[model samples]
Target chain A: MAQATLDIPANKIWGGGTSPFGASYGKLMMWFFLLSDAFSFSSLLVALGYARHVHADTWPLVENVFFHFPLTHAHLPLLYVGLMTFILIISSVTMVLAVDAGHTNNKKGVIFWLGLTVVGGLVFLGSQAWEWYTFIVGGEGVVKSIIVDGEVQKVLVQGANLQNNEYGHTLFANFFFFITGFHGFHVFSGVVINAIVLYQATQGVFERRGHYEMVEKAGLYWHFVDLVWVFVFTFFYLL
Target chain B: MNHVEDQSLHYSRPHSRTPEESKAVRKKILVVTGLLSLITVVEILIGVYFSKTHVGEGTWTLIKWFYIILTLVKAGYIVLVFMHLGDENKSLRTTVLLPMVLVIYLIFIALFEGEVLIQYVQEFMK
Candidate 1:
């Protein structure tokens, strides 16, 4: 029988009482969670891409689909989505600031930045809700063919749902709802978590604990949300 | 609890950094944000321009590739900086990144299989 080594220092390789990955257990767990989440998102996106490829000729142009801007009837392709992307990215920046503040044990700074992050998340969520509403209640209209009583009839399709959409393929709207809706849910949860963390920061909980690791962990989640949006913007909107 | 007594706790450690360090960190954060925004703007511009003008099929495909590359760049930067992955140990970084190879493989198989199915169906119909 092999004898176990007994003289290894606690901080050395294969030693006990050390963070093997050089990060706290909670943070590493968060990374693993994010990695798994990334797979889920990517699988959805790849499926979307496959659907688009299959329906390439008939698929609605993304720019034409998302052309309408708020308060202006003018067609501004990608303007609103772009603004939403910017808002989310800026929120990620604020989240970083909040994490940095946590590192320095600045209670006021953590509260302020985390508050901004929550607000940014809320704004992005609100924008997504509006976008979904617009999509469901579509603008203009596309003529769709239907068979009625053994005769072909021409009918206009407006708005979107599981069954019908103004866009060319129903799969387009399905993927839109499924992918973005899932991401929007993530943003929603992130905002709620930020709110709780902000409240705790206001109470100086992390200060008392002598670490702001909670903020860092939350920041990782927020940034991952933003990162996923980047791919969504490209695959769903830009391409 | 008194301030002095609070300081005696094991959890108490001075976390305050020099103003210069804080400023530098803030500047780095701003720079990354600027880069992300710039990439978004470029993506939008290319999309709009291509939508307006009739481009060759090859050119359009190239533009799509460009968009994917740019998006990846932005994602990498956000993960590295905002997630603080860049500051982590090499083994930790690898632990996070190594699994991504599987994701890429998944995407490739999905796209390839989808294309083959589409082609088969088209041939059958013809």
Candidate 2:
């Protein structure tokens, strides 16, 4: 009986010597990594929600706080972040095209689409840097009463920091810096990874390997970055 | 040169497609992108214009719910299509989505606890 069982082919979906989920090891692991990352971001956003609810009365209106745009004196009211969202979404499309081209073994298509994706990521990082700059510099300072040296004094506070902000509550800037800054770091890392993969593609690395799986893996990471940004954009800016 | 072509090692889809198939894939990408863009535009319009106009009203809360739902729709598309989870085996899909339930549970717990804490604080201050 033991010999018979050993001789039988384990051809079931969960059988040995085959992937259970029809995905390669690397891709499945990437998905799990993204899931864990999702947990991290969800925790942050949920905390933000809780804090926003707790401070409902004094919470600053996000639009009123983020009104400025790059090189524009006019108040744009979500236009700049909206542009960022489009850039991210477009880059995500390009990433999917890259993966599709990889599936077809089209080296040129992979390089082109991946190149555009890298450019999109760089542009987004630059845009985020500008936004951080605007936020740190802030607008005309807000005057608030503070106790300095045991006496109440009217002090003008400008910009945002860990301690205080011209915005209504300190937690507002705290969450803003933490969440967006974390997302920006992810974007920066994605760009770096994409640039490296693009360089490898130019060197015909995947072509010689007989498959462009690396590009697809990189594309997975890239699209995940875009996916996280979708939630971040909604929670941080829109809602 | 050696080529790796094992179904177990490679992805689920074949490594090449016909021109028509590739075109269809590209078309799907374009369609999804357009849908995502449209939803974002609608969200911004509501967030910017209607939010300002509806301040402190039931409609504002309703609009927020609308935005959240639309955001979820966009997120689903990105994960399902762009990341190609929709193309994966059913087992893979379940594996990925099942854990997300915990996240939803956490959100509700946090929101509910926050409400209770704020109520207790208000009563204490009074």
Best by DockQ: 2
Per-residue lDDT over A114-169 for candidate 1, one digit per residue giving the tens place of the 0 to 100 score: 99999999999999999999999997788888667889889888898887788878
Clashes of each: 0, 0
Which digits, one per residue and each the tens of the lDDT, describe model 2 over residues A1-239?
46435554344436566777877787788889988998999999999999999998889988888888867799779989999999999998889988888888788998999999999999999999999999998989899887789998989999988867898889999999999998999999999999999999999987777777778778888988888888888888987
Q: Which DockQ values do the candidates obtain, in the order shown?
A: 0.48, 0.64
Stretches of model 1 off by over 4 angstroms after superposition? A1-12, A147-154, B1-14
Q: Chain B TM-score of model 2, please?
A: 0.85
| TM-scores for candidates 1 onward, in order | 0.92, 0.93
Q: Mind giving the per-residue lDDT tens digits that candidate 2 earns over B11-104? A: 5342667779878988999999999999999988877787644577787778778888998899899889988889887888999999999998
Alpha-carbon shift of residue A81 in model 2 (angstroms): 0.5
Clashing residue pairs for model 1: none
